[model samples]
Target: MTDHLPRIVVGYDGSASAGAALDWAAEWAELQADEPHEVRAVIVGTAMDPVLGGYRARNDDLLERWRSEAEQRLAGTDTAPGQARERVEVRHGPVVPELLRAAEQAAMLVVGSDGHGLATGTLTGSVSQHVARHAGCPVVVVRPRRSTVANRIVVGIDESPEAGRALRFACRRAQRTGESVIAVHGCFSVLAHVLTFDGAESELAARSLAAGERLVQEVCAARAPDFPDVEIEPEAIPVRPGQVLVDASRAASLVVVGSRGRDAFAELLLGSVSQHVLHHAHCPVAIVR
Candidate 1:
């Protein structure tokens, strides 16, 4: 099998959100690969110490139970689903670390918000946040698993090369699925993020808007001219790019953002706009490097 045949790895802790994510990943795996795609569902064992409860052997027992339940969950998801190869792994490590390790070999990592373990925030689930920040691969966060909504696909674009790569990925996926692409380039004055540049807010906003428009044009020019005739809309919303993208993601089928690269200011390798959208977007979010 080709190393890049597009496998989908999902995190599972038996939460509703995690189940939804697994279903989405299975569906995605079947759709993205012609050959049997790998759909590995990994369970991050509970952190609670069974030994403390006087059941020292219970740790392994609990993990075994989790694996069986996970397999059942996978079987339950097989409602006329595609023919992707399925795997269930039970590990006793931190959720995020395990997921990230799995992501190293997979094409994409799929996760859920508010899983068996989580608090709140965009990518509200701990696994979502950790993968978004640390994983070298892209992560798709699926939220509100029960909703049968066909939302649009949103991609955040800036002048960075990674952003361009992210836009292209989002557009291609949208075309295949007949989903709308909202290529949003969030723009605001540098003053918005920096206090020293306060006085030049108006001029900075103007510059940001202008740059955003130019970015849209550049995207069209650089990307395949006839790639599905994606409708390009240049946006100059005055807010942090991450915040703007998150807000725009409410009804999107997928939100795409660049990985926060070495350029901490823009290039997203992890824990950037893509991460936020992954959690906040009502649908799924893809992080591109």
Candidate 2:
């Protein structure tokens, strides 16, 4: 039964942020105690020597050390009794590829961000960024938080399929954690600029707001039956989608967004709004594909 259940994989490297991610993942698994999941941690090692012209085998002592540390961390995480530290895998290869492979069939992949401020900013070449963009499953990039009192799951809502999936994911999480959901839709439309010359700016803005509200309502209504007990609050704000989500993240436990929005580039792996939120959101951000 455990093998058949979905896996929740955590990328651990013994950093503070990684330890936080492991704790978060373990607690998330505990939330699903009614239907247990397979929770595991992975540590990726290059173990390569350019001068040797071949991959060097990992020393047994070093492998055991990593495994031992990961297991200890998992055991120490706050989780329900009888929760086993199932697997602590140490794989050798490129970091991103190894982590992706470890979570190929996972329900969700949890990773840590450096929690850097605007001055330092999130690096484009970081492992979490690459994994969030390329992973087949939903990827959550967690940052160390000062508090978790804010229990709202803020999600960006739109008519796109990916956005709908993101909303569903957020609703499911809210259902499990007893958190509320905030469905936000930006009402800034390109047509507002053209209508300004004709003195129809106010009218356009009202229409845009109404349309945005309808979109959010319809989307939330569709999922209402599935999440009967989940609380959802819809908002149609006249602001940029990224900015709205970033502001909401300040008081949110988690901010969820689709990998690609309706107007995103077809060739891009990650959407601009998601990238912006991932870089700027105050809380953990989950990129659903």
Candidate 3:
């Protein structure tokens, strides 16, 4: 069953975005050749009931055709020869749930921004959103367009544990690809605005910026020893985290963000900043939970 290999699950539905996602996943698996990883391309379809007694065979044949097409598409993905270890899985059920189940044992779950039934220009499909928020492991949402910035990975930094996890994930990727890591920390102080009327706005703003810089440095310093080879560029911005990350995404190969932050409501599965970046980032987004 090759269960010993690290598994990566990708959703495929014969759409352009899905094809791009498959290619990304295959290439990612190939890059991990030294680590021995496997890519599982999962194609999900709803179960259909026969309309009549004689329609049973027709339904079965249609399902088989879909499976065959999925297999062919999986085989056509561009990957390093002898480096990609992949398999196609056809399941009868809803897409998001099937993929989530498959991700139970997978190292990562990947999907496209748009799919067969998903609308265009929406940034992210409904299925991708659901899975990214609820997947057991990290989720990578790949956009259709190929990324031009392949030399760097951008990750959001905060006080949450998930933020630390995201940083570690980005560092590991940077280590493997020889890419630089951009650690961005966004800080906005409500006290600075309130103190504006009291004539202390400038003083408070400066303090806020210094605090932001310290927080970023502290977080990165703790993990610096573990990823000594990864080049880290830390930026403390005075804007919303989502906007800063979205702007950074324009020149980033990948944007990694925590699913939830320290300020997020307990009941929310995804933080507002992460959600915003997932929908507006130019390149692929990875939600680390």
On lDDT, the candidate that comes out on top is 3
Q: Model 3 off-target regions past 4 Å?
A: 50-66, 76-84, 117-124, 144-147, 193-201, 266-271
What TM-score would every model get versus the actual structure?
A: 0.79, 0.86, 0.87
Go through the candidates in order and give each one's C-alpha lDDT.
Answer: 0.68, 0.79, 0.80
RMSD of each: 4.8, 4.5, 3.6
Error of 2 at 235 (Å): 0.7
> lDDT tens string, model 1, 156-181?
87767888888788877766576777
Better of 1 and 3 by TM-score: 3
Q: Can you give the lDDT of residue 55 in candidate 1?
A: 60
lDDT of 2 by residue, 1-289 (tens): 4667778888876567777788788888888767667778887655455545332443445556667877887777665555554678877667778788999989989988853211222211287888888999999998644356998999998778998999999999999899999999877766775566665557887888899999999999888889999999889897878889998999999999998888756326544788888888889999998
| lDDT score, candidate 3, position 79 | 53
- Report the lDDT of model 3 for residue 282: 92
Which of the predicted structures, 1 or 2, would earn the higher TM-score when compared with the native?
2
